[model samples]
Target: MTTSDVMQDVLGVILGGGQGTRLYPLTQKRSKPAVPLAGKYRLIDIPISNCLNAGIEKIAILTQFNSVSLHRHIYRTYRRDMFTEGWVEILAAQQTLQGNLWYQGTADAVRQQLTEIQRSNAKYVLILAGDHLYQMDYREFVRYHIETEADITLAVQPVEAKLAAGLGIVKRNSDGQIVEFCEKPDLDALDELESMPDSDKPFMASMGIYVFSMEMLAELLASPGNDFGKDIITGVLSERRVMGYVFDGYWADIGTIRRFYEANLEMVSPTRPFDLNNARRPIYTHPRFLPPCEVYGAKLDQVLLTDGCRIYDAEITNAVIGLRSIIGSKVVIKDSVIMGADYYESEEDRTKNRQLGRPDVGIGEGSVIAGALIDKNARIGKRVQIRNLSDRPDETHQNWAARDGLIVVPKSAAIPDETVI
Candidate 1:
């Protein structure tokens, strides 16, 4: 089939499950896909935008685990015009006559929603992880899958030894046929999983991006076991034609606090590896027609400032200032991700906050925030220092937590004045 034809017949199934405990505090109120990214967009936007750009219009986001915000975001952002058959919808976990239980794992999540997914009448189902940060034209992926005549085609990327242990490593032959698959193997099993043994990045790690024939997908899901990497992929490797498509691109799995922090800070660099500004393939999100960002005599360096931000005289470096962020004078922010406020605080709101003895939402005056992640609508008080000066590995406080060597302030949290971490 032609590339265009295949793309038209493709349905994107984004797996948006898991408790996402690794990305705690951020994922405490929302799912992994609902987590904020690049200051302005959510983690799910990366995959959804990619699908739209690739002309795969029909999409089903399988969301579970604190997905209220995720569902609302999707409802507000994505909508099908009357002209096209394209539509993006969410398939939440629901109780049916079969059973009333939560999603077991990746495969189980998809299997549970297969009845809804099949309604698209798609020939191929493009399985994608909603929380990953990357940009790819999946039209080529679908076309390649059809051309290869394989039952399964997974997107793989090379990873070093350190990252291999935490990811699903694949062993592919010279012809790109994945021979063996292992999910988070230990040090002893690492050597055997190396696809390019001579190279710096030896092991080929699965990106959790897969393309499966509709029949093959249904067939595999009918069997036992839950996760695709742990059960499905390895189970059908020997009998089925499971091909590996090596993608040498800037891909990141922001499942951990450290990874999430690094991914956000990487955008603040002079040389941006993952550029979000593509005219043809722009990263989309809810268009809140908010006003342009306003800055006042701020000495900024390597910062990503988004919409509706009002910054006063501040020294910010290597940080991502998200939407509606209000940074006061004498504030020093370095190497941090201020997710900003979900809604701007009005004069009335400030008066109420003052009366209640709570700091207004955003970075307070005379505060120093370094190596931190201030979540949305966080109320930081004056003269507060959140640099993790104590250098604690993991410590959970009332409103904040020190994790992965960085201080994380949860959403809508209130921190009083003169507090230090």
Candidate 2:
């Protein structure tokens, strides 16, 4: 196939149906893809933005598990002239010949939406994940696939050996053709590979982004597979021609709570692994109508607070605050992730100790917090004290504390003010 052949009618499909169980309370009400990102975007927006930036207009978002918010956001933000040609659309599971149940797995999710995909009449299909933060031009990957004429092309990155355990490892020949692939290999299993890069750093990690010929995806799906990475991809790794596209760009799998918070905090730095300003490929998210964030008598440094957020005499450092959140007087929020929105102790009640919202979690009018994540729509009391750590190493707490001392507060929890530890 020539470059033009692959690019002639490219179809973009995003797998956004996962339960996001790892994110727990954050995913309590919303799907993983709908989770707030950088206080201004949703996780799903990253891949959609990549598609638009790549000049690929034909797209389908496959979603399940509390997808209303995800659907609404996509519809509201992207329903425009751009989608008229090979437009962007949402493909939810409906009653079909196979079954009426929800998606069984990643592969099944796509397979279930075969009818919608087939309508595109596209020669190539790009499968993507909605729970990641990165920017890549799919056109480049498509061009590479056409040049190599490989059955499949996978995007991979080099990560530490320990971290690679959770991801699939690709073993490629000198020509970049993948010979063998391992999904979540044990620590001792890597010693057998001769081509594995021998360095202080570890081996490569799978980015979960794939470019597949429409025929190949259809054939693979028909051959009996439950999941994408675990079943279909691995089953064909050794039998068919598969190539690995080693990606050196910024990428993070927001699969867990700690990872989700860490990724948000990383953005507070002046220089981040992922640069959103790159004109070559820009990231996308839902648009917010709120005005610019206002900070008055607040000390903010190395923080990313979205628009419509109000900060009053608060000291915030190294944090990511979502839209429409408010920080009250003389409060200090440090190294945390705060999703926006307001709530109330009582719909008719509002007081220093009774106010509801992000800043409503009162800090005793003067309290300190470090390394914590406060979810959206929470009511916190004034003069209340909460920290990520305890001075006594032997003490046991109900909260889950990360190895780096980050504390997580469940979403929508009512924290009374003047409550001290």
Candidate 3:
């Protein structure tokens, strides 16, 4: 078949994440996929954009936990033109005659919606995680799967030993045929799981990106399995024509608060690991046609400042200031991800803020925010210091929390004037 025909035959399924407890309050009001990332875009945008860029137009996002926002985002951002046959749809888990429970795990999630997925009449199904950061061309991955006539192909990458203990380690033959798999193998088991003997990053880790032939996907879902890594992939390793497609690109699983915090900061670093602004491969999101960012004497060094921001004589370093952000004068924000407001606060909104004894929906003057993540619509008052001064690894307060010593101001959280954290 031609390349266009092959792409037409492929359907992409993105597994919208469950209750992100590790990501906690950031996910308190939204699903993992709906969680904000890199200032303007949400996590789900990554895989969807990758699919659209790779020519896979018919995509479905499986949602379960706090999925209203996710559904709304997909609806608003990914609407296809009237002339196009492409669509990005959401598949929510619900009660069925066969089962009433919500998805138990990754495989179970797909199994619950297998009938719906099959309705696409796709020859191949490409499965992707909703909450990952990377740029990939899936055409090459599908091409590899087709050329080798593989039943299933997993994108694998060599990761540092420190990261292997928490990831699915795979042992593949020289021909890239996957032979063994262990989910989150212990450090002691690394020797046997090493796909590369003496490489600097010895263990080959699964990137959680997979492409399965349509028949194989149906056959595998017949069994009772929860997660893909812990149950399904493990059970089929020795029996199936599974192969590993080695990927040497930047990929991150921002499943935890620390990883999420670090990943956002990395975007504003000098050595940016992943570039979200590639002209040829743009990351798509909802177009909020707000005015250009208004900056008056703001000293920004290594920052990702999005649209509709008003910064006045502030010193910002190594931060991702999101859209519609308002920073007052003398504000010092460093190593932070400031997810700005959902809507511009009118005079009435400021009146409500005054009644509640909170600042307006932005960072007030003379505040210092370091190593923190301030969620959208937060009201941080003047002289509020949020640097996690206690040095606690994990702690939860009323309006904020600390994970890995990074202060997190939850969505719509309010920090009063002169309050120090």
Candidate 4:
């Protein structure tokens, strides 16, 4: 089917209500979907862009916790023209006489916003997570769903056995009919759900992207379930016609500090699976008319340097540098994701900061940061060291933290000189 034909009766719903406890500090202030990604984009942009590119423009983003930033971003970035019927709207959790509750889970978030979703007059609902990193043509996914006559279609990806345990696993027969679905299965459960015919790919993991017939979704939500994986998908597998569409692409659930860090780093690699350079399906974001990034005497390799950064005599390798980052001389940064400053400090701002005894925004001189995620507007003093020496799985220090062996300096945090993490 053509793109227009597939998108005609499809409505997009992006679930952005999760607290994202795993990606703390980043999500500490903003919601998971509002978290900055790949130096320039936000996590919410991935699925929204995919929907727009697929010609499905009627979209609703559901948000709850710390949704101020998410709301602001959506308002500023996605202003549909008056002539167009397409729109991107936000559906925040609210308290009414019916109930006073927040979003319980993914399915619950959508359930609460059913009033808005039902107004679209669409036959299919394309549900997407707001925190994953991948590029997909939802047109094909929707077409596949229609061809199979599935009541519910899940986008599944072939994952290695080691990483399969943490995701929702779907076991399908040769005809692609989903027979069983397990969410975060244990070793014993995984063995039973292993791929049929036993090929190299032993597991089919759910990508958290689903297409549901609007009628089926409404009926399912009428019951008392809150989550898609834990409750809805598992509960309906027996009685419903469900199918799995296998996706062979780079998809990362950037819900944790480590996963978020690793995905950003992977974008700077010479050969990465996710492509941000696709002109046909470009990722859209808020347009900023900022100056080009400036690098002086810096030795850089495998780096993605965003606009309005100023680097001087720094040695950076295998890093993703966000916008308006200011790096000092003799600084050595490796394997890090620097979420750059929100705004550049003018001379007056710098002078006031100095008078107030506050360090400038960005890295200080002679500092070393490796395997770290430097959040926006962080001020690292001179000679500060942030390499995770302890390699602890998780630890929280003052203004900074370590999760899965990666150091995370929260937004606007200040690290003093000679400090080491």
Candidate 5:
């Protein structure tokens, strides 16, 4: 098929309705897809940009929990003027006269929006997860599905033996035909389902990405099932011609707090697998025309400083300073992900905050923040310390919390001066 033909035949459906219980505090005010990433972009941008880069334009994002910010970001970033007969639309969970139920799982989310999906004039449907970080050419994936003549094609990744049990393991023959599948199998079950023989990475893990013939997908959704992994994929393996497409690229599911923190830190590494700097397929986001970031007498190493940041007499290393961040003098931040402020606080706003006995909108002077994630618009007062010293797996304070030994200050939270965690 020609590029135009492929573009016309494929519809991209992004599932963005998960509760994100693992990434709490960060997800306290926003959905998982709306969570900030790489100092600037939201997690949802990864999938949308991939679809746009692959020439798949008519996309639908399914959102449910805390969807206001996600909706705002989508509308602002993906403008209709940018494409011809192309659109990035949102399908939020709603209560209709027929039913008043919410999305129960991935498959159920799409099932609820089946009417809208059927309205699109596309032969195949490409379903993607919104919170995963990776760059993939969906055109190649779709072409592979067509070549295999598959009713359903799941994108799988080779993972180390240690990590195989946590994912859905797929066993495929040499022809890429999926023979067996198991979700979150035990060690013994994973041992039985190993697909690769010679390589160090012997287990094929599902990426939660699938391409399906429109007819097949509609028929599958007609049944009573909630999840694709736990329901549809498992049930249809015996009946349908299911295939697997191996993806040999940088892909990280930022589901848990540790994974989320590690993924953000990986972006600042000198030699990382995922490169956001690729001009050929750049990640798109809501454009904030803020001024350039300014660093004044600050010591920095391997830091990603986005636009509209002001650093003064601070020390930072292996950190990501997000947009519109303000770091005061004598501050020390290391191995941290500061999500930065949504908007710069005006002088009047600062005065009002002071009157209300609140610190300004960013990190304050002499504060030491290490191994942490400071969400957007947080206020850390002077001499505050936020290192998870006890290495506790989980703890919750007034406005701050610790998960997996990493301190997390939720969005717009205020920490008092000289407070220690």
Candidate 6:
């Protein structure tokens, strides 16, 4: 089949079920996908926006753990009902013959929602991870899948050999067809692959984005398997004709807290990794009723603040402030993320949450906070210094502690003024 004649009816499915345990306190209240990004948008918005920009409207977000925030964000932001031609729906977990518990793995989640997929009448199924942050046109991938006439197609990119070992590694032939796929091979073998510098070979790594024939997906889902990557996908890769679509776009799986922080900081850079200036298809999110952000006595540079936020005498550099959040005098918020109160608070008492959105740590009237993450509704007392430079380079996940010099105050925690945190 030629690229021009490739099949076209593709349905986008986002797997948003992971507990996001790696993200700790951030995911402590909401799912990874529900985590706020660039101050105003949630992590899920990235993929949904990609789909929208790619011209794929029919999407299903499969979620489970702490899905309230994810569901609410989708409901408030995306209007599936408004679309006359397509739809976007959320599929939650339910009891099944497999078990009464939640989804077993990635494959199981899709299996549970087979009925919904059937109803969509989609010829191709595009599976994606909701926690990833990237901007790409999946239409090109779909076109590649149809042109190759393969059973499955995967979107892949090259990463540092050390980093690629942690993700699924693909060995492709000269024709760019997947020859072998392995998940997290040992460092020695990875080094061996890296040592052999093939002129035509590319260090293709899986982006956790896939396109599968409906028949192939159904067959794989019905088969007994604990995971798609470890069991089904690897099992099939060695047998069937699986193709790899090489991608060089900016892709970052915001799976860890530090990565999340780094990804946001990228936005403030002179040249951002991800392009937000695309006007062909704009990213959509929930509408806010609050007034524009009000900047008071603050020294701000290259920061993105949402509506109804008041920045007092504080230094906010390369950070994102959520909606209706109040920055107190001399409070410093730098290189971190602040989630909106609506995501963590109940509907009845959101005003209360809004009222508590300030420094929770006992940062004095003139304190400095650098490279820190503050939860909503925290009261930081005057003169509280929270700048810790001791961080492990190898680990992407870490907890906040006074010993580490990064004091994290939980939401709604009150700290008396002038008290040190």
For this target, which candidate reaches the highest lDDT against the unseen true structure? 5
- Please report, as a residue range, the 10-residue window in candidate 1 with the lowest summed lDDT: 386-395
lDDT agreement with native, every candidate: 0.91, 0.76, 0.91, 0.89, 0.92, 0.73
Please state the error at residue 247 of candidate 5 in Å. 0.1
Clashing pairs in 2: 361-380, 363-383, 364-382, 364-383, 381-416, 381-417, 382-417, 382-418
Q: 2 or 5, which is superior by TM-score? A: 5
Better of 3 and 4 by lDDT: 3
Cand. 3 Cα-lDDT: 0.91
Q: What is the C-alpha RMSD of each candidate to the true structure, in Å?
A: 1.1, 3.5, 1.1, 1.3, 1.1, 4.3
Give one digit per residue, the lDDT tens place, for model 1 in 148-225: 888999999999999899899999999889999988999999999999989999999999999998899999999998
- Put down candidate 4 lDDT per residue, 1-421, tens digits, no spaces: 5669769789999999578888887888999999999998899999989988999979999999999988998999999999988899998899978778999999988888898899999989999999998888898899999999999999999877888888889998788988899889998888788765367778899888999989999999999888998899899889988999988988998877878888898889879889989998999998999998888999999999999999999999999999999999999999999999889888998889878767789999999998899999999988999896554768787789888888899999988778887
Query: How many clashes (backbone N, Cα, C below 3 Å) per candidate?
Result: 0, 8, 0, 0, 0, 17
Estimate, for each residue in 1-421, the C-alpha lDDT of model 3 and write its tens digit.
Answer: 8777899999999999889999998999999999998889999999999999889999999999999989999999999999998788999999989999999998999999999999999999999999999999999999999998898899999998998998999998899999999988887888898888878997789988899988899999899789887788889987888999999999989899889988988888778999976988899999888999999998999999998999999999999998899999999999899999899999997998799797999999999999899999999999999885546868899989988778999999999999999
* Residues 186-210 of candidate 6: C-alpha lDDT, one tens digit per residue: 8777744432255333367888888
State TM-scores per candidate. Answer: 0.98, 0.89, 0.98, 0.97, 0.98, 0.87
Instruction: List ranges where model 2 is wrong by over 4 Å.
Output: 1-8, 194-196, 200-202, 342-364, 390-405
Report the poorest 10 consecutive residues by lDDT, candidate 6. Answer: 394-403
Better of 2 and 5 by lDDT: 5
TM-score computed on alpha carbons, candidate 6? 0.87
> What range of 10 consecutive residues in model 3 has the weakest lDDT sum?
386-395
Which regions in candidate 4 have their CA more than 4 angstroms from the true location?
none
| Worst lDDT 10-window in candidate 4 | 193-202
Q: Point out where model 1 deviates above 4 Å.
A: none
Question: Which stretches of model 3 miss by more than 4 angstroms?
Answer: none
**CA lDDT of 146 in candidate 1?**
74
